[model samples]
Target chain A: MDITNLESMPGKKIVKHLGLVQGSSVRAKHAGRDLLSSIKNLFGGELTSYTELLQESREEAMDRMLQQAKSVEANAILNVRFSTSSITQGAAEIYVYGTAVQLEATE
Target chain B: MSGGSFQLIYVIGLLIVAYLIGSYREKRHYQSIIKREHALNSLPAVNLKTAPKGHFQHELVMGNVTISVDYFKRFLALLHAFFGGPITSYETLLDRSRREALLRMKEMAKEKHAALVLNVKYETVSIFKGSGKSIGSVEVLAYGTALIPSSQAVASNVATTTQ
Candidate 1:
């Protein structure tokens, strides 16, 4: 599919305006690493545990975004973005969004 | 020991514990900031080249990246405290999410064979907020045309390199 035909391709498909598709998920943990983080902070070093946590959360968000795109029958997505917020001291939300487009040939 | 002296000793012990915990928290927060900055710096620089008119190009795929909010909240809380207010956790969460989204968008550009991503945008919403607690999240979107130089352009580059 040519990039130009990504929009306005023939066939009475349910064309979504602005292709504003979104996906989100919430996660919570029992503050397991807070004490460890405190200790690491005092000693002056990297907190490897938190590094892993961020990575996992980001992946979950992306997966959700992709799933949303698939449901809409979009062959390609453009202008994808992400966001996060705290639900509580120990919980957080990750969200992903993008324009879902169906491609078509220009000829 | 006298009663007054006993009370003094108890207070001193409590202060010592508070000092230890406070110092530890401070140290951990700084360490995380340094790590995140390092990660951001390590990313490769991207360059874009325009494609020729009327020529279709192959699809490109970019790399992937992940980020967490728990780690990010610590940094936000510290920043919020600096401004003389109760530590706010939502700031950190939103910041981390935005960074992760941008990284992922960049990865997609690289994979899609695009030289650059442009016209990026961001949006956020509040999911939960209450007494002594508030939570919200943000989304960032990046979009751009993926392109490669025409055959003629490629040939010229090859000739220049060989010469």
Candidate 2:
């Protein structure tokens, strides 16, 4: 499926609007990883483990969003957006939302 | 040595060490960011929702980074919070993270040989909230649609419309 953050896909027309499809994931690192991160925080630098964790969470959320689009018979998702919120002390929630639409080639 | 004196000395030592190392690393990161930004200046990323008229292949590209604040900055931030003034220390942290994320996204665009990226967007999240001793960290994500010029142009007979 074609996906873009733009409102409409270029060179294509939105044949049908499938409404909104959304997905979210809440994730947290293990205690050991959290401890390591705090130590790294002492010196200030990039947290590779946290980065990977959030990246994976985003992908998972996007996958679920795509599944919803697929279920609606939409060929593409448009105007996509992402948001992150701290749910608890250590957990983060990644939310992705987009408009599902059927696209037809103008050619 | 008395327990109180030893504890004070240790705290002071930790702050000094943290300040030295943190500033050094931050400087290095800024240097790298500037160098990469200069190198990637050719590839433009814009927030325009509509793609310019053309025959191109569009794909989604994204980059993300998570940066933790050092002990020194965290302490300064706390002071700033109490004093009600700008916390300059954390400013550089966020700036570096945002720039790094955008650079990484542009690098991805370069790898795909895309002419440019459109509809660029950013998401910033302050995670690992300051609780139970650990300080907070920020995560920045940059994403956009890469328009790669197609090698074989589609038939010109097709009517192209943008809405």
Candidate 3:
């Protein structure tokens, strides 16, 4: 399925609007990575472990959103946006949302 | 030298070392960011929904990064608070994170062989949400649409030139 953050797909016709679809995921830092992160923190640099955690969580959320769009029989998602919030010291939450729509090739 | 002068020399040495390491790290990070940005300059990133007049086959692209402040930056920020002035020390932290995020997104677009990325957007969140006075980890997420020019658009010309 094609996804774009624009309100409409260029060179395509929006045949139907499928309303809003969203997915969210919350993940906590693994103990092993947390330990490594703490060590990295002492030296002062990028915490690869935490970066991995954030990446994983965000991807998971995006995947779930796509699944939702698929269930609605939408061919594409538009105007997508991502937001994140920290739930606690070790946990992070990511939310992704967009409008699902069906597009037809322009003649 | 007197004991007092010797102690002064030790303190000064510590400060000098801190300054050297701190500036060195900041410079290194900036240099890397600049290099990555230069590599991605050819791939246009914009907030427009429409493809650049003559483009086809658009896809979604995303990149994210979580960067943390080093000890020196945090220490300087704290010291700046005593005088109630702006905390320029922390400015680089956000700068690095945002640039890293964009570079990552651009890298993904390159892998997809995309010519440009449109409708780019950015979101930033502090990992230390509830904690006050401590911005431990900062994350920036960048997303956009990658467009590739249509081969079909040039197919007619190719056919004529060959004939």
Candidate 4:
């Protein structure tokens, strides 16, 4: 499905509003990884382990969101947004949400 | 060696190393950011849902960055709590990461042949919380929708480059 963070697609018409579709995931690093991060933090740069963890979680959440939109027969998802929050010291939660709708080419 | 004196010595050593290295890295990152931002500034990323009047198709674009405070900043931040005023050190940390995230979004829009990105948004997540305190690694994600012009002249580049 086509996804855009605009309220309306620039060159397409929304034929039907399928409704809101959303997905979320909560994740945390293993103890070994968490310890490694603390050591890495001493130097201060990108935390590859955490970056990879969050990236994977975000993709999973987006996949679930898309699946929800597809279940509603939406061909497009609009006004998409993502949010990440810490559940605990070592854990994070990611959420993906959007408005689902059917579209028609506006040529 | 007395415990108290040893602790002070270790903390001081950490502060010196972290301050020097962090300052160096931040300066280099800023230079790179300025150069890339100058190029992507023309892409016009905004939060308006309405696309400017044009014959264009819309595409979603995203950029994300993760940044952490150095040992020095965190050490200073812990002390800032006692005074309870504006934590200036953390301010720079957040500022750099936020702008970095936005610049990345603009770069994404430019690469996709989008003239402008609309409805830009951002989300911040704390990746690591040190001892349940005020120091942590945070991730910032900036996203938007790009308006890709439909004119054949401009469209030719995207067509030839991607497929």
Residue B23 lDDT, candidate 2, scale 0-100: 91
Q: Write the per-residue lDDT of candidate 4 for residues A2-71, one digit (tens) a residue.
A: 8887777756788999889999999889999889888767756667788778878888999999999989
Q: For all candidates, what are the clash counts?
A: 14, 0, 0, 0
Cα misplacement distance, residue A20 of candidate 4 (Å): 1.3
* TM-score-based ranking: 2, 4, 3, 1
Q: How do the predictions measure up, each by TM-score? A: 0.44, 0.92, 0.84, 0.89
Q: By TM-score, who's the top model here?
A: 2
In candidate 2, what are the lDDT values of residues B85-141, reduced to their tens digit?
A: 788988888899999999999998887778889989889988866654434789999
Residue lDDT tens for model 2, A14-60: 99999999999999999999899989878898999989999999999
Best by lDDT: 2
lDDT of 3 by residue, A19-102 (tens): 999999999887887777665553355777777888898889989999999999999998888899987777889998999999
Give the share of true interchain contacts found in each model: 0.01, 0.88, 0.65, 0.66
On lDDT, who's better, 1 or 3?
3
Residue-wise C-alpha lDDT for candidate 1, range B5-73, written one tens digit per residue: 999887666556545654455456546655654655533323333333444343332222222233234
- lDDT for each residue of candidate 4 in B1-163, tens digit (9 for 90 to 100): 6999999999899989988988887788888888988877777877877777768766777778778778888878888988899999888878888888899778877777778888888888777877647776888888888777777426656677898
> What are the per-residue Cα lDDT tens digits for candidate 3 across B1-163?
6999999897666556655766677689899999888878988888777666775777788888877665556667767877787788678878888888889999988876778888899998887422358576688889998776677426534665899
Q: List the residue pairs that clash in candidate 4.
A: none
Ranking by lDDT: 2, 4, 3, 1
Q: Write the per-residue lDDT of candidate 1 for residues A3-105, one digit (tens) a residue.
A: 2212222222433433766777777544657555544433222335544454467677767777777886776665455566766544557776667776545
Model 1 gets an lDDT of 0.47
Q: Evaluate residue B32 in candidate 3 and report its C-alpha lDDT on the 0 to 100 scale.
A: 92
State which docking tier applies to candidate 4.
Answer: medium
List candidate 2 stretches off by more than 4 Å. Answer: B131-135, B152-163
Question: Candidates 1 and 4: which is better by lDDT?
Answer: 4
